[model samples]
Target: MSVKKTKVHLISGFLGTGKTTALKSLMAQKDPNEKWVIIVNEFGEIGIDGAVLSDNGIPVAEIAGGCLCCTAGPQLGNTVQKMLRDAKPDRLMIEASGLAHAASVIDELKVKPLSEELEIAAVFTVVDPRQFVSPDYAQQALYKDQIGVCDVLVASKTDLCTPEVMAEFHEQAAKLFPPKAKVVEVQNARLDIQWLDIPVIEKPRYRLKAEVLPDNTMGFQSEGFTFPAGQDFDGERLTHFFNDLPKMTEGLVRAKGVFQVLGTWVWLNWVDGQWGANQVSWRRDSRFELIAKSFDADLIEQKLKEALE
Candidate 1:
């Protein structure tokens, strides 16, 4: 009887492949009438994408840790529900983790007791310049699913490679999909609002099974830490402390959590750097959680201890 109040725009991509860049670009140009909320799988335990947007004065809701398709479903649903209730955004953009399967995300769009106000807008799958060619390429079922479901396929960093490679790349890649999706490579991934509304048939819903990860290489545990009233931490000091961690963590996949430094809550992110110096502050959310793929728990525990000391 009532029109859906918001449409969900799912932006699925792998880690560090420019989904954040595209997302921020689109959000900044939005008309105020079109309030947009972003659900990022990574809240910058590495880069400050979310913090930068929040600092620029745009509202972003992040559901990080593991892949959204696998790990953050409840958080994703709850965040969406809250956004519809509070901000009533004209569009909702969810940036799935690089490891995330877009099919699982679509199935989630059809969640039980579907909210009356939520409409499925479109699915955008982002690919890196090098993604389609790597040995790791075939391992990326998430990437393929991302493409198979997209109303728009965004190829980020097209200027860095040749048209021949890009074209051949697409031709080979096309074998992965049905003949319905469009692939458009961007110069620097400059996205406009019009790109957000391409129409495609709604995909068949996906079902997910529980995956038991091996304990040896890449798995993570999350715990919430709360600072009592009047607690204070030095932000600059905290950043430098974690920066020294890269040397200690060699096989680590990713690790990040929100914690207090100088009384301001900051997100600490890491992605297997030789050193953790590449980390940046998201400057939001007091609550923190960590995700690791192939990290040794003892090594991570040692690094974490060094951070707090």
Candidate 2:
């Protein structure tokens, strides 16, 4: 008698592209009777996405401080093995770090023991249309490689893009050699659950590079800071602090933090010159992370400290 293998799906995307949001949307539409587990990987030391996703009342395993395809490869394999043994979930969904190499991760899952217990399902890569048209994101080798490995190309945050940006996104997506299985535009990361059932097609044309590069090869540095649960931040002052970071700290590209503000907790996101925040129910210690081409650590710390109440 043979046991049924667990279905595995990969969610790949670049930094700050709303991959977590898409995962949440999918979870909402999942079968109520089936057991599902999630594995979230992050480039930062602190696991913000994992913590946020845990609010859904599901088991979520987080691998942080490195890319799952490289520095965290051993950890990724170990986590998968343990999850299979302990949880025995009917389905497993992995949200790879924005900087992760999808091909490398897929290779890891195909190893002997793991390959026997898990079957790769459709892979989805989420793209922000605004970044799709920007040279800063479009010209990067990692960005193109991410799109190259996807079975589905998800254009997220389309509601925020202009007509020109949307047109360019559609044009570029259509030009890919081995075309994507499906290309979709979604708002707030709402993905249709039916897409998850799409069968995986093997593409011999898509090959992984012999040498795997470290996450830092992209010239980005990341730092994560945590504060005690009792620590409180002045919401107004914190807003000003984050708003000034891009100008105050050179090379600042992405920054996100969950802070205790007054009697509530708020989640703040800063990316590509845009800032957004929302109230949330997280009760964990206040924490934040910053990713930049390069920046002064001491200066950033000092400014953040000044925002404390």
Candidate 3:
């Protein structure tokens, strides 16, 4: 029997969502016998999270200047491969960018490079305790999507919010989240480190261990599309499309992409929400890729078709 225990834990949230604190807390609570490989990605040029995890002796591999969902895809994948080859750690934790959408990250695992080794254990998204009460969150599309897609949603920094505020936020967030994922509060900095030890990535008896790219996307049950540079279109309309998506979404884990078009080519961008073109028009081309655990592909297709048409 193979003696390798390769499982991946993805921690995704928007900026200042307390991913670092949650990771630090989780690492501190974990048993020393359990070795962990942390893959951290951020927009900042320097790798701060990796250094923090390093202080805890958790053998960290940081990938800076990109979100773990896309920019750091190869680096994260390679770092993970090397870790397995060298340290053979018991578990892996991917501290994704605060802005990362979990659906896209999980979708990457379903296809190439990562599928060979790593298996996702759990998906966690950290919510800033204060944001739920803020007017910005109440109106923002990304805020709602981040909370809705995670397998485990944490109302972090409970100490700051009053009991009533916490309770109301919990009720509101719970209503927005998927029925399957569990939501909890992390106030006392207490976390059940045991969850990592539980073989969370369910192994399929007959799994698809194959390399996938644009052409072979559909077979994986998690994939997206990319249009050529000439396919540039309206940006505001695109955003409006995604903004209205949350109402009809089903099984959408996470989705984000960077695109380019004339005058907008220099400014590469991303889209993450229930109602949006699952693409980014950055290079004068319409490139969009979406990854989901399981979602209403037909509905997504219908919407995109309507928007593009």
Candidate 4:
């Protein structure tokens, strides 16, 4: 009997860094014969990434409500162990929370039962070039630590960044960090599969914090609502609701979820100032996640409830 060791890839990045977009591209190019599993963790209580990944027909496990560094760590381990026992995938990919500490996740993977059956393939850190211009981001601990912990650095959304921003990021990234295996730019999160083949040789220098990660430490809050199972939202009404979200909610950052729309389900996504929605396969529970720096959760919930009425 031969033992199969699953190759595990950890995808890390700050919020809006295109980790999910990159995963979409990778999944599109997956070999037909290979069985791959993805575990998605979101900082928000309402799980959105799992819905997005589930559209691809891949096996997905979700750890939501907190980061893998703390609250979701045990869930992550249990999910991995179960997947290994049942699915027996050829590879495993984890999309951790944007604010998550990659070093802590790696530390978790290296412990006990998971370490016995899994091999660390690569840790990829995604960067949004636009963030390079933010002086505050340069000062953030999670942003800086995310960069420090990856074997490969991927600058995503290249098409959206100006030439000068790209040039500046390239020059600064090279000078700032320790030498890594690879640093590449990807347009629309189109990552190369060859990078995934590289084995993890050097572990990250950032150590996991011994203390519990403080609540709302990232200065962002998430409020989510689950709609009743039998209710269905009118498409026009839902669109109107999302269109008005940015204007109504104070400090609104990102919103995502699946809603039951007239016997069909549609996924709506909003980030920064833009919103988009598309019809998707049906999901029983209709819900939404609102991420903000500050907001009146009750008011937002009222607005959504009225929209469905």
TM-score winner: 2
> Model 2: which residue pairs collide?
none
Decreasing TM-score order of the candidates: 2, 4, 3, 1
The residue-by-residue lDDT of candidate 4 on 22-123, one tens digit each, is 888889889989899999999999999899999877899999999998988788888999999999999999998998977678768867778789877778
Lowest-scoring 10 consecutive residues by lDDT in candidate 1? 204-213
Cα lDDT of all candidates, in order?
0.58, 0.80, 0.60, 0.77
Q: Across residues 1-309, which tens digit of lDDT does each residue of candidate 1 receive?
A: 767667787777767668878887887778876667776776334434556556554567777666666657777778777777777777777777777777667656665544466666657777775776565774555555565566667778777777776877676655432233456777567777786666554222211111222353333432223333123445654566457544444434444444545533344566555223222222112232233333344554444444452
lDDT of 3 at 301: 54
TM-score (all chains, Cα) for each model: 0.59, 0.64, 0.59, 0.62
lDDT of 3 at 68: 62
Q: Lowest summed-lDDT stretch of 10 residues in model 2?
A: 204-213
Residue-wise C-alpha lDDT for candidate 3, range 180-288, written one tens digit per residue: 1456787654456765544322221112223322234443345454444334446665566556555545444444443333324222223353233322111213434
Please, what are the lDDT tens digits per residue for candidate 2 over residues 1-309? 997999999999998889999999999988888889999999988899998899876789999999998888899989999988998998999999999977678768877889899878888999999988888987777887687667789999888999999999988887553345689999888899999987554331222121221265677666666675457899889989987888766677667777878756677888789889865433335667677777777787788789999
Tell me model 2's lDDT, rounded to 2 decimals.
0.80
Model 4 is weakest, by summed lDDT over 10 consecutive residues, at: 204-213
